[model samples]
Target: MGAAPFPAGILIAAVVFHATVVLSSFPATFHLERGITANYKLKLSKLKERDRVRHGRMLQSSGVGVVDFPVQGTFDPFLVGLYYTRLQLGTPPRDFYVQIDTGSDVLWVSCGSCNGCPVNSGLHIPLNFFDPGSSPTASLISCSDQRCSLGLQSSDSVCSAQNNLCGYNFQYGDGSGTSGYYVSDLLHFDTVLGGSVMNNSSAPIVFGCSALQTGDLTKSDRAVDGIFGFGQQDMSVVSQLASQGISPRAFSHCLKGDDSGGGILVLGEIVEPNIVYTPLVPSQPHYNLNMQSISVNGQTLAIDPSVFGTSSSQGTIIDSGTTLAYLAEAAYDPFISAITSIVSPSVRPYLSKGNHCYLISSRVVLRCGALAFRKFRVKG
Candidate 1:
């Protein structure tokens, strides 16, 4: 079924908005570097004063549009959806509007002062939720915290000191913005599932934690709460899932939108036959399924990774947050040309946008060796 991918932030993320966010977060980043030797640097790109307001307005209703699609279906047990949060900053001792990221391992929210401040200066919560101020051990870490001495290589003394505060800086895509540190706190997550499809079960996991806030975009998302890092580390959220026997690789997503609330994130292996399949065995520790080759009706494109300034091999990452496949120019060109041959130029643009777009009136097929995915239209 056709589905609309992410619908957020249209215009360039504005400069005024980022200026405030950056200035507010800048101090924490500085404070962090002094106490801890920077290891995995948060590689951030200079934020271009883009049309951020346009994008923010569009994204305001991002989750609403996907709900209109008509393919109500079942998701593989390993596939699940993400719960995203958008927030603001500047206020303290309350909910700092924050951007929630699950792909990360750290479990933190904005400190009460730093957390709710970003969200309309309004932090909404139910009764059982945490009150950052009164919560246990809720205080920013000083430069002298043991986390710094042990050389934890975390966000620094700011994040490690008080066991409650951790300075942080993280980056996403090349064109995407960046965020800086605030403090640490807990977070919450909810999963859904059941039935003979017993391999998958869903429940809500609440992380009563907070994290430092940061982001270059005015509202690229709310001040970042803690990241739900899946990597190895005691503080990783995966620790929580493993306790309940939830496997990591067994995850997927169908975020079509609010109407159906999209798909499930299976914590174990799940195979779905109907949703086109590509038998990818993966290249070692990559954990990623391999894309050995791509061909149209047998003839392949002369794909050279060096030309595009990227590896020529099919080393693509499967990310839920990414709306479409973003191929390096070298790879994208030939694929577009080959696919262009299958249909009129009019339909080529959409196909170039992603692997899922319609093929128009033409028949299109993509193959990975013997396995292939073909698209055809059936009229009622």
Candidate 2:
């Protein structure tokens, strides 16, 4: 599958919550940064590499406690390989910049004793570590803990018999990995009240304190404290908070893909009059969507529905960690044919590094289906 730029609009993912709450609404919102100088090819390759690895396996309360942290990184995965946010952890909280990834479970940051963890980042952000010894509130998650059992069930963490510590080792498709033990500590943020009012708050949450990093994670380029997983597993921050009744069982985000590159992520649902709801493929490890068909310029492409079916090797996954949209070969062929047929007359279409590229004049408006591209080279 080849990569294509994400469609222009707000990207929202709202998972259904089984329980209902009757408290005052607290909407925790934050901003995200997009890397403007990241290597596009490198980002695209990483996305594909991640997809290959993914086929193998797979917020708040208060007042109804909604906690908001400042986010950094871009909405466009092509422009920036990742989007991250700063989390305040431990007592007398210290800032830790962690990648915001929806693909994997468990929130982890480098620990004081971490080895192979980059001390600097090419992203131009300061990297910090979480020291359990320094935080009086920080506690090691015992192997016998219920959370440890859950983590083991989800392939998120391991239980050591000798020390009885709950630890984790997560491997990425790009060969990057991080390993650490779980720690219960204070996670600080701003609690939003009535949407506008803000109050300081802290919650005890279980997160990984990374002791080792490997592969791309060890590189100074694009390095951060660690990753903040927004996955559906029980060990994710979302599930931890929901279990404690501090927040609802749902979360949402609106990503901006413009040059300014900022977005809003909330711990609760966004009630918009025009919002549409879609059912998620149930019991899947990843956020798999049941996509039935593809449409180009109001004309439906003649692709088989089963091409988008869920299986060990096939399924439609909505992964924010990925930089571009990937279509199965069956769907990709017709999709590219449709788009090229529409704009071929106005531009020179060719193959560049396995992607379909189009060189067009500044005045040419490249339109495919409902999407319009202008003033730049188009690649897919």
TM-score to native of every candidate shown: 0.44, 0.75
Clashes of each: 77, 14
Predicted structure 2, TM vs. truth:
0.75
Candidate 1 lDDT over residue span 1-380, tens digit each? 22354344332221231222335653643222222232422211212112222222322221211101112221221122233332221223233222223334344443344432244311232112235456443444434544322214433223433444434444554243323333333322322223211212332232324323334322322223333343334344454455444434333334444433443332333343357655534332222344545577688778753432213343444444433345555555676577567755655335333343443345763312111122222122
Please give the range of 10 consecutive residues that has the lowest summed lDDT in model 1.
61-70
Model 1, position 68: C-alpha lDDT score: 11
Identify the candidate with maximal TM-score.
Answer: 2
Task: Write one digit per residue (lDDT tens) for candidate 2, span 113-217.
Answer: 789999999878898878999999999999888878768757877888999999988898567888889999998876554444344577899999899899988
What's the lDDT for candidate 1?
Answer: 0.35
Off by over 4 Å in 2: 1-63, 194-198, 361-380
Backbone clashes in model 1: 77
lDDT of 2: 0.72
